[model samples]
Target: MARSSAGPAVAGLTAGALAIVGFLAFQASATAPDHPTQARGDSHSSAPGNGGKKKSPSSTKVPADSGTGRRVVYQLESRRVWLVGADERTIRTYPVAPSSVDPDPGAYAVTSRNMSLVGSDGVQVEHVIVFHQEDGIVFGFSAALDGSLPNPKARKKTGAVRQTRPDGKALWDFALIDTKVVVVR
Candidate 1:
């Protein structure tokens, strides 16, 4: 009888712990500039003085194309994209069109979005794609599409598909959009 009573209590405690850790992790990320932009913050920038909040850079580094100097391209996550140069430290951030997903929203890369739109030909307003990761760290784009989440089709590019994490449980998953890693320069 005691064992049965303890099961739910233990589960509840675990859930509570996970939630706390997730939230703290999320807070650290939301306050910082780098953590994959999985969550949104009201602050302009944690970078003191500038007060300018830049978009998060993609985990995948797109190499420069020839003497292009610096070519700005799109990321699969619309909300956050890139400004890649010979120097990785020189990346920049900008806004993206809000995702068509409901309950929560996301971003996409401009390059892939344009292509998908052209191919879409007004067929539909959204696209579907999948991202794979383990231990909450995203590896890269995946060939699979996950439509089971609250959003039927997610177009956010960066950190689109998030797994349960220690901090705030915040995750970004790319659902509705098709993406590829290519040098658009």
Candidate 2:
């Protein structure tokens, strides 16, 4: 009687395959979001995580003249940013720390993005979304790794609009490359 070697080979292959699949599954779960339900834009919905409730009285409204359709509205005067969905509803709006060198009030698109980098101010920042560049100054939005705001007293010409870590994540998720960005006074 000849012993079949194919059985041991097949079992080994199966074990290796299962190990790879288990590892992949673990990796996916580790990076997955805690909340499984993603928010979709609709006329009745009031931003993600709101559960379709109306915006609170304290929440700032998107400017009337911030341009229509999906766009990021940066209010230079108010130092705020509004992420407007295609439905013209404000998905998220939050305050930002303006940079010393402000970009001209105009329309632009997100040119590039970096996950992490050392900011010009010598601070570690993340979620950098570059939109406009003028002269030699690069304008973008980022959040400090330490959750610190930009130093207004710094004399360097940097156009880094700083936001909180959570806000940075939201903006990172909303504004992608080529997304319209409108700057208004």
Candidate 2 to truth, TM? 0.70
**Alpha-carbon TM-score of each model against the true structure:** 0.28, 0.70
lDDT against true structure, model 2 = 0.77
Residue-wise lDDT of candidate 2 within 78-141, one digit each (tens)? Answer: 7878888888867766678876888999999999999999998888999999999989999999
Leading candidate by lDDT: 2
